[model samples]
Target: METKTKKTLLPVQGKILWDVIILSILSVLCFLLPFAHYTYHRVQWTVSGLQFITGTSVQDGEVVIASQWLLIAFIAAAVLSIVFALVFPKIKKIRLAGFLIILGGILELLFSVLFTMQVQYIMADARNAGTSYAAWLLALIAVITIARGFHILYKNKVLSPLDFMIMPGCIYFLINNYFPLVGIFIAFKRVDYSVGIMNSEWVGFSNFTYLFSSSDAWVMTRNTILYNVAFIILGNLLGIIVGIFLSEVFSKKLQKLYQTTILLPQLISIIIVAYIVFAFLSNEAGLINKGILGEGNEINFYNTKIYWPFILTFVNLWKGLGYNSIIYLSAIVSIDKSLYEAAYVDGANRWQQITRITVPLLKPSIITLVTMSIGRIFYSDFGLFYQVPMDSGALYSVTQTIDTYVYRSLLQLNNIAMASAASAYQSVVGFVVVLVANGIVRKIDNENAMF
Candidate 1:
């Protein structure tokens, strides 16, 4: 006798079919519920169904009232979505359509809970006595439903394979990084903490009034631009020269030792090194005083703001040059030795070789480093400005950049929202600078332009 066989399905293969079946059941249960509902209240004239939908309190003898209209609306949306998805599962656009429906359901459920409490609080205000929120509840239902629809549309999307890999990262960024990014709006607002993040009324660019449409704007702007310009040009130049010289000067036996010596300061935190600098620069019992100069009363370096630009640049070079040089070292070492040997055989001097072979060969590394560094031009190292200065008021004039200004403001205001806004502003300005710099590079040398 022949027997008919039943096919077995795997987990994923069975899930869609099961979802469709469950959705059918849920849709039937949900669609049958009444759209309008009523509640009873106490501590006042006994209230019943106030309108098409009502909001009230059902406290003690007074029963709390809630319509759950938004909840019903979401359930209705979800039910309609299941039916729609059952009809069209393969269409790409339906993915977005279906997501919007689920989003609406979620938002409606959320706001329904929120508004329930709000309306109850307003009505139950013993201060209001017999005041009722019946009309307000009806209006809330309409507003919430519409808000849910807009929010749903905003939340919908189509995910691809790449998005699957990046979705978790994207979520992390949205919460940790992007949400803080919204603080840029504060830069344009006369922001205060009273109204909180969203409900604050707009101020029509009053906050930026401090930055643009002023004269001191040019001072800060010029200082930021020129300081970074000097650092990039001077930093890379010194780093490359040092890297090449060290690569040549050290014997193979001493190479690691010499590299480590150059790199040792870099391994230590900048804050720690700033203290070391303090020891050297201390006005009393300092090594520079007792050991070197032996001068009486010593120089109060902190009070002299005129000397800071040079001192800060020097410190930056000492701490950062080795690391930057190491990057150039990788490029230097990878250069073809045959070119150097041929030049040597042709009687090329070391200086000539550097001019012809080294500089030209290092162009790619130069452009890459310059491009990356340019992206940070509008920003400054926080530790250098804050810790190195020991937060002295004396150095505030020359040392204050956009970052330091923000830090000082936050310290004074203790408002995290404004801090976030300042950070967002720095990022945007830095990004703009990089793009403009890249455009200039592309015009000058397309091959070396980043992107």
Candidate 2:
């Protein structure tokens, strides 16, 4: 007997919403249509023959670069958005359209700046390239409308709603985090505030040379990486142990008390913690010297460099242990009880159950936490290294970190450009390190990887 085969049908994909279509059409129109024209206005005479959209103008009978690149960027972005809307129509594709539109807006801004800067050069026979307020308005509208369309897709459930909630935060980061990237220009320039930021002389990497040429480079770099490595390894190990122990406690009241006691340190301000450390380690009035070691045998703990590595490590673990363990404890609590019951049925002891089942189950969490920690391996806790050690010059060998070094240099030199250069270096290295770490995690176990 021949059996008839059943044909399986895939779920139909949702169509791109009307809002996205309307905004995309508008964006394309803004790019293609004659939205604005460049003109020259000096004193009383006026010249208005430059067309921005077509990138053409008869200025002083000579062909000039009339914002051609800016127009190309806008047209390219608009074409890309239309292609995505029609061909793919996925939420991710719509989001990409929004990103392209933002880029186009940025290009419009650059065009205005460049044209303003070249207004004098374009002056031949009293004709100069001038910016049009309409171009800026059209670019602004395109960006806002595209972003609104992306939001509408999320609201209609064509995209995840969670993304819509974080839109405000994304905007904040774009403004705060990414907008500061313009300062990188200051890093490369010999910033003379006397002649505004844009008019500053370009020095071409001279600012960065001082950082490498510094005598304390190796010491600071070594201390930062080594201390962070120790913290990451020890922090994860102790956090896991404490978390497991906390989870195993039978009384809920006792668990709460233990959790509260450990967590209190995390809430305390670092400055207060610094003072508290000072109170304990002060030579004349220290609790350690007068109360424990006796007044005659007092040690100037602030000036002592040798003991700070161990001291800082201990303090870091103590302050952060409770907070870090809470994450592990949450994962532990969510685990299935039946597995433990089955382990008990097989006559497995508590230690055996932990070793065999609990630890194995916690692997993903541990891996995830460890991967994140490694990303910050190039960074050091500034307060722990600086304030906790009292920033004593004697302790520089042991306590100096990238942040502290930058802070110290900034204070002593008061050179904004140099400080900016250091910051740019740190940001670049940190970014590369994070990417490398995430890549490594993805290679090992794709399931537990952050990306």
Candidate 3:
């Protein structure tokens, strides 16, 4: 017989020292590497009416300016935090280090912004100068180091083996989700590529105008919110119903068959699903038109917008119900069977048992799922709105949503600033809505609410 050993949690050795070493290396690199380039140029232009035509000009060699020293201050702060972490084992001292790291990160940001402004004012052509990749790496490293200090301060000791297991995922989230948040600045910038992202003039909410100023804004916003609300309500309702029904069936063979059949649709790609929909809905050479409805009174499903609301709702349910139901099914399966047995002994019928026992038990899972869904209410699946309709102009009024609108506008205008602004707006609004929903849930039923 093979024996299985239990794993134990232990603090990682030299974890703090490793972090300090990495921080020290990056800090030194900040001073040694070229922070940003300073370009000098002479411009000669010929006037034609109010327009000026540029002529060829020689570029002066790039200069490494003195502003790089600002990073030295940041490096000093990081080193101080690391030293404190090593020398002082007290909680207050470690916390002080965390505060210092945060202050250093903030100062770094202000310094970089001030440097960009100085570059813009000094030489007109110098505005085109770009910061080196090293500078960006330094900023990212500073933030990570700050976060590390805080984590250490929280635990007041080395991280355990269990913490190490989750470290990779935490780092990935920081890089993929949190780091890209720096690009939110693009939403406020005019974004002249000739002048780099940092050097671009701040337009202050001008990019947001593109989204709300259009005549179709109201229609798109309304459709997006309404469809999401319907999806949340209907999806949860049907999922719960099917899950409960499945749990009631005692046969193993029939239950597996039903589960597999329902889940198969979720595994299929949306593009393939669109083609299947096209086969049934297409006016010309369609299964419905030629085979079922026959020749005379064929419906053009693609062109007509009225039928789409129903079609889309049905399609969403068909594709999503299987996956959504699995959550409720798992919860239901874990419920104590003794409760149902006791209810039966009390002469409770199936409907009464479900109402009194099953529904009440499922409350926590339902509230959690709904709260998460609310966070993404402003977002829509792009392929559903764009590809499923076959890009029909007539159907756009009903099918158009925030995701599709941003995609189309991105292609048409090729303005990244506008797209960034739209995305930032969606994220902010969704965050606020989720917070409000969670707050209401907490007040109504504190035990079932998600914190």
Best by TM-score: 3
Cα error, candidate 1, residue 391 (Å): 0.9
lDDT of 1 by residue, 1-451 (tens): 1232112223322443344444435433432332222243433333423321344443333433343564455456556656654654443343354455445444434444443443344345343334234323433443443443444334344444565577579658756875545347665555555644444667655555545564535555566666677788888988998888876864876777777888887788878977988888777766776778777756788788887888778887887888888898889899998998999999999898888998899998999899999998987777877788777888777777777767766788675444555566678788898999899999999999997
CA shift of 330, model 1, Å: 0.3
Candidate 2 lDDT over residue span 1-451, tens digit each: 1232111111112333444455556544543343323344433333221433333444335434444654466556557656655654444334554454455445444444444334333443343434444444555665665555565455446667677688789879977988778568777887786755566888888988977788667787788889989998999999899999999999999999999998999999888999998899988788999999995788888887778999999999989999989999999999999999999999999999999988989989998888888777767778888889888988999998878887887787677777777777777887898888888888988888888
Candidate 3 Cα deviation (angstroms), residue 424: 1.5
Please tell me which model should have the higher TM-score, number 1 or number 2. Answer: 2
Higher-TM-score candidate of 2 and 3 = 3
Model 1 lDDT, residue 120, Cα? 45
lDDT of candidate 3 over 204-279, digit per residue (tens): 9888886689766777778889999999999999999999999988999999999998898899999998898999
TM-score, cand. 2 vs. native: 0.72
Candidate 1 clashes between residue pairs 3 or more apart in a chain or in different chains: 42-62, 57-64, 58-62, 58-63, 58-64, 59-62
Deviation (Å) of 297 in candidate 3: 2.2
lDDT (C-alpha) at residue 366 in model 1: 94
Per-residue lDDT for 15 in model 2? 35
Deviation from native of the Cα of residue 141 in model 2, angstroms: 3.5
